[model samples]
Target: MSTDSMERTLERTRRRFIRRQRTQRWLRWRAILAVAVALLLVAGAVWTVFFSSLLAVQAVDVEGTSLLSPAQVRSAAAITPGDPLARVDLARIEGRLMALAPVKDVEVTREWPDRILIVVSERVAVAAVPVGSGFKGIDADGVLFRDFAAQPKNLPLIVLPDDIGQDAMKEGADVIAALPTELQARIDHVEVESVDGISLVLDDEKVVVWGSAERSADKARVLDALLNAAPRASTYDVSAPGQPTTSD
Candidate 1:
């Protein structure tokens, strides 16, 4: 090719390359600017969340405190006004409140915007038992709830040994269910020696002994015969099923 023609072609190619580079630079700048703006917006959103007035607890709604006072529960929850409701650790709050003697269960939940709610079910005693200090009416789970000198509620008394555990409570319920209607009504208190051995102290001060958790239905039926035998007895042994023996 001629020298003049080759030089002209080289200059035109150089101009086109420079223009393309500028265009590429402008596009790159636009992309960088967009990314920076997005990052700024995300940072602002986080800041707003961390410092928003909505996080403060404006009110507290407490429910399920029939036996316990709402004010008392609120105090126990430690969720007062001006606290950070959004940052409230529910697990911690529930744990703290559950330590109360009267509380069986406790729950805490957020009420959105600026509120906190707490719900609690106080323990109800089904029977009284002797603990360290004195006799206390305990719940079905064998948890000590209320003190009882003679009788707290109209519920039947449960006489358990000092070594009795939660299993004894379950054994008591089972024995109560197996007893006859008439005999069950007359039963004022149930004394369990162990899961393997149980006794019923009737209102008439008679002791009905149950041998074990096995053959419960047969043992309960024979108890009626032993009670009606017209012979004053010290212990009615229902452990032997049909052949119940009494010891005076």
Candidate 2:
């Protein structure tokens, strides 16, 4: 080959190599810049969620509260405004609300940018127990929650012995819960002597011998049928539900 031709070919090859090197260097810098930008975005998001006031708590909303007021729920939650929402302890807030007697279950959650939500499930009273001058409300679970100035007409009175155990109170509550709605409305009070000796006194002075909490559903069904069949009966024995008896 001629020297001039060889020199021209060599110059072209050198220029091509320089261009490729420049392109490769630019591609590597682009990747590095992309990764850096992504890292900066992640760091900024973390700061906003964990430390910045932009995502801090501004309000606490309460839901499913009936026995307790919204103010009571908020006070129990004790979440401070301006605290980072993402950093708020939901489990801790729930624990605090559960400490209240009327609260059966509670769930605390963050409502995004700046709000907290506390949902409470309050206990429903099934019976009222005479306590001093007032009456204490007992739920179906036998948990004593609130107090009434006087016995609520809607709830049946529960007469438990002074030394009655929780089991007896729970048994009485269970018996009342098992009764049909129609029969429950006729109930005046329940006398619980022991776990196995629970009785229901109807509004008309009729007595229902409900032996124990066991097989209460069966007993409730039998008693309902007996009441319909012998409407004039004064006492009903449904301890053995399969063979119930009624006496006037």
Candidate 3:
């Protein structure tokens, strides 16, 4: 080929390569600019949310608790509507609610856009244990809740073991429910010597040696039979099956 023709061909090839590289560079710049714009838009939206309005609790919802008023439960949760959801911690709210004496358990869930829901489980009073001036209401699991305003007339008074404290108060309640209604009525108070044994002091001053928690219902039945066969003020000892002993 001629030198002039060869030089012209090389120049054309170089020009084409430069044009293609420019197009590619332009495409990369455009993509980067578009991503930057999108990120700025997201940042603006987030900033508006955090600063445009006063961050305060706006609304609160409570569930799973009937005994406590919504206001009470919400107060316990220490959360409200209008509060910045970002700073609103569900764990801290749940912890505060659970700290209340009446609340047994609590769960906090965030309903996005502006709402907080607090679900709660209140302690269930299983029975009452006599204390000074009033009776301590024990929950289903034997945890002591609160003292009644006045002595509960219909509620059975349980005598808990000294070590039972507030937690084991429920055990005494379970034993009370295990006893037969007829035998339960003749009793003034039940004595718990360790959750292991339960003794009943009847109106007639007779002692029921109901040793251990085993066969409590059956043992109570035996006491009923003995009472029917005997008179008031009779001591009916039922520590053993088929060996009920009565004393004057």
Candidate 4:
């Protein structure tokens, strides 16, 4: 081949190589730009959820608050307005509301957009004890939660021994809760010296020897039959329900 022709072919090859290098560099820069753009979009989405006011809380709705007012629950929750809904601490809110004595269970939830909902369950009282000028009500779990100036209806007075331990209190409350409504209404008070020594005093001055919370349903059925058969009995013993007795 002639020297000039060979030089021209070499020159064409050099030009093609330079063009390929430029194309590879352009593709690498384009890929880096795309990754940077994706990272920025993800950061923006996170900021919107955690810090932006678009999803901030504006109202609090409370449900199942028969014993506690809505205002009381909201105050206990201590949720700040204008905070992002995703940033609210639900477990912390539940803990604060459950600290109240009457609250047995609580659920805190985020209602979409601009609201928080709190639902609560309060304990029910089955017995009462005099404290100062008021009566402190105790539930079946022996938790003293309610306070009233006068005796609450349908709740029996607690006459357990002085310094009665928690076991006696729990047993006495359970016994009182197990009585039928008709019999419970006729009872004036309950006395408990020990877990096994639970007794009920009727409004008519009749005495009921209730032994323990065990077999309470059987005892109640036996007592009902005895009271119906001997309505004038002064004392009724149902401790051994299978063999009940009455005394004049």
TM-score for each of the candidates: 0.70, 0.89, 0.72, 0.83
Q: Per-model C-alpha lDDT, please?
A: 0.77, 0.92, 0.74, 0.91
Runs of candidate 3 with Cα error greater than 4 angstroms are 1-8, 34-56, 160-164, 177-187, 202-206, 211-248
lDDT of 2 by residue, 129-197 (tens): 998899999998888999899999888899988899888889989988877788889888999999999
RMSD of each: 4.5, 2.2, 4.1, 2.9
With candidate 2 superimposed using the best TM-score fit, by how many Å does residue 137's alpha carbon deviate from the native?
1.2
Give the best candidate by lDDT.
Answer: 2
Task: Write model 1 residue lDDT over 1-248, tens digit each, in one string.
Answer: 99999999999999999999999999999999999999999987665555556577898889888767888888888875776666778898898899888899988999877888888888876556656656776675657766656665456667787677778766775666566677767887887887767788877787877866567788877877777784598788887887788888
Candidate 4 lDDT over 133-210, as tens digits, reads 889888898777888899887678978666888888898889988989998889999888898998889999899999
Q: List the residue pairs that clash in candidate 1.
A: none
Model 2: lDDT equals 0.92
Error of 4 at 1 (Å): 8.5
lDDT of 3: 0.74
Which candidate, 1 or 4, would have the higher TM-score against the true structure? 4
- Model 2 regions lying over 4 Å from their true place: 224-235, 246-248
Q: Candidate 2: lDDT of 71?
A: 98
Error of 1 at 163 (Å): 7.9
Off by over 4 Å in 4: 1-23
Q: List where candidate 1 sits over 4 angstroms from the true fold.
A: 1-23, 130-135, 147-150, 159-184, 192-198, 211-234, 239-244
